[model samples]
Target: MSKTALIFWGGWEGHTPARSANIVKEMLAGHGFDITLEQGTSVLTGSDISQFDLIVPMVTMSTIEKPELENLVAAVRGGTGLAGFHGTMGDSFRNETEYQFMVGGQWVSHPGNIIDYRIDIAKPDDPIVAGIGGFAYRSEQYYMHVDPSNEVLATTTFSGEHFETIAGVVMPVVWKRRYGKGRVFYSALGHTADEFDVPQMKTIFERGALWASR
Candidate 1:
């Protein structure tokens, strides 16, 4: 049987969570994985969650119920892989403390929301980013306050024509961290549908999802 993947997407509409989640769900389906898509995290009951191999949160912002949040954290820690991009995974759950701990990072700011920037692949031999290159992107260069324990996979240095003294700062744009028996992968790309469709971005996102699964 094909592997099962659950995609929970909903929150503030500003981040375009539904669109991002659909892109990933379609890609995973193409890879022969059975995929389920949900509009919001509220629909995930504990029993409803136990049937999948992976849990993907395409949520951007909002309060997640404590029970739902615990179920999600437990699901991943108990061996279900979790992966997604931008605030959908990292900068999510503005009021849920446990949710933030489960994902391990949060988006603090993106100086100019959408502009061009360079993302450098730091670990070339890592399966997810092995052949990925330094690519130029036209999207938000995220300024995130991340967990120090995360294994940084790729980074983007901040520089732009709109500001001064914001140059030469390298922050993680992609990373992974272990939680119990599961694996978590996060990419800071995908600020827009077109951004997620970039060749390099698609490779990173697709490979990350496959790698994060149990």
Candidate 2:
């Protein structure tokens, strides 16, 4: 049976959630997933979220109703997968501690906003990053508060050019973890849909989504 995915996109327009949703929808569909694309977090309320194999939240810096947030958490705890990229996953629901805990990270800042940086594959043997070497890209280098339990797959060193205090700090750029019985994956890339045009970034997102799905 083909897997199902629900993609909720909307919140901060600066993130271009709509375009990102479309890109993800196409990618997931190509992988044989039945997609349900919706805007806003209302769709999560009282939904039988466990039925879907994967959930992708393209929302950024938004608030979700308590009951809806509870439902989404329950679903993941019950084995439904959750996967997303950039602030869509990491920087969302800023006020919700449980939500942040489930995601395993929260974006704190992006120093130097859209500057050139290098992403190093921390685990080259991992299938999600296999054959991909440390590559350079120009974008926001996300500084995040991450859970130590996260299995970090990739990282980037802070150049200290933007924020002198955090200079040389190695921050996680890609990671995967388990929230209860569900799998969770996140990448601090994809500030825009066009970022997906990069072969390595695209492949990482694609493979990470597949890996997170049930």
Candidate 3:
């Protein structure tokens, strides 16, 4: 059976929510997904969202109503898969810590803003990042506060060039975790939709989302 995915995108235009959602839609469509792309968070204010096999929130740093958040939390906890990349998921819902709890991390800063860095596969045996070696990347090197329970798939070391105190710090770039019976996946890469052009980045993103599908 074809999997269904709901992508509700709207927030800061700087992050290119619409473009990212389009990219995701095309990618998943190629994989035989029936996708519904909505424009805002209003989609969640309704009844149940547990009908979709996956939920991808392309929104970044936006406010979600209490009841809306409650419904989303309940749906994910009830076995709906959740997946996203960079600020869309990690840095999204700035005031909603409960949403951050479900996402497993929150972006506090980018440290250097945008610079060249390398991402190392932390778990080479994990299918999400398997066979993919470390690769150089250019974008925001996210310094997030992450949950230790996450099954880290990739990591990147901070050079301390931007933030001295965090120098030599090892941060998770990709990870997967469980919320009740549902699977959640996140990646710190993809600062922009164009970042998906990188083979390694695209591969890991696609794999992680597929793995997160219920």
Candidate 4:
């Protein structure tokens, strides 16, 4: 049977959640996934969470109710997979510690806004990044507070041109981890759907989704 995936897209308009969701939906569908797209977090409060093999939250900086957040967390912990990119996952739910814990990271800042940077494949043996060498791209270099337990796959060094204090710090750009029995994947790329136009970014993001799905 084909794997099932649910994507919730909405919250901060600056992230262009709808456009990003469409891109994700198309890519996953091409990978033979059965995709369901929703507009808000209300779906998280419902009982249908168990039916999905994977969940993608394209929401940014949104508040989720306690019950809704609990249900979503339970679903993932019970073996449903979760995966997302950029602010949608890494920068979301500023006030929810549990949510941030499950995600394995939270975006603290993006120094220099959109700027040129290199992403190094830290774990070249990992399938999510295997065969792909470090590459340069122009986008937000996300400075995140990450869980040490995360199996980091890629990283980028801070140039300190924007924030002098964090200069030379190697930060995780892509990582995967387990929340209970479920797989979780996150990438700091994808500030816009257009970023995926880069072949390497597109490949890593798509593979990350597939790897995270149950």
Write one digit per residue (lDDT tens) for candidate 4, span 1-214: 9988999989898889999999999999998999999999898876579779999999998899999899899999999999999999987799999999999999999989999999999999999999999999899999999999999999999989999999999999999999999999999999988888999999998999999998
lDDT tens digits, residue span 1-214, model 3:
8999999998888889999999999999999999999988888876468888899999888888898889888888999999999998887799998999999999999977889999999999999998999999999999999999999999999999988898899999999999998999999998889998999999999999999999
Query: Where in model 1 is the C-alpha error above 4 Å?
Result: 46-48, 160-165
Please list the Cα RMSD from the true structure of every candidate, rounded to 1 decimal place.
Answer: 1.6, 0.7, 0.9, 0.8
Model 4's C-alpha root-mean-square deviation from the true structure amounts to: 0.8
User: Can you write out model 1's per-residue Cα lDDT over 1-214, one digit (the tens) per residue?
Assistant: 9999999888778778878888888899999999888887776774657557888888886777878887888888889999989878876787776666667788888887678888898888899998777888888888887789988889988874555667778899999888878889999888766676689999998898899999
Total backbone clashes of candidate 4, pairs 3 or more residues apart or in separate chains:
0
Give the TM-score (vs. native) of candidate 4. Answer: 0.98
TM-score of each: 0.94, 0.99, 0.98, 0.98
The TM-score between candidate 3 and the true structure equals: 0.98
Residue pairs in clash, model 4: none
Please report how far candidate 2 places residue 13 from its true position, in Å: 0.9
**lDDT (Cα, 0-100) at 58 in candidate 3:** 94
lDDT of 1 at 138: 83
Q: What is the lDDT of residue 127 in candidate 1?
A: 94
Candidates' lDDT values, in order? 0.83, 0.94, 0.92, 0.93
Ranking by lDDT: 2, 4, 3, 1
lDDT of 1 at 185: 90
Candidate 2: tens digits of C-alpha lDDT, residues 26-47 = 9999999999999988889846
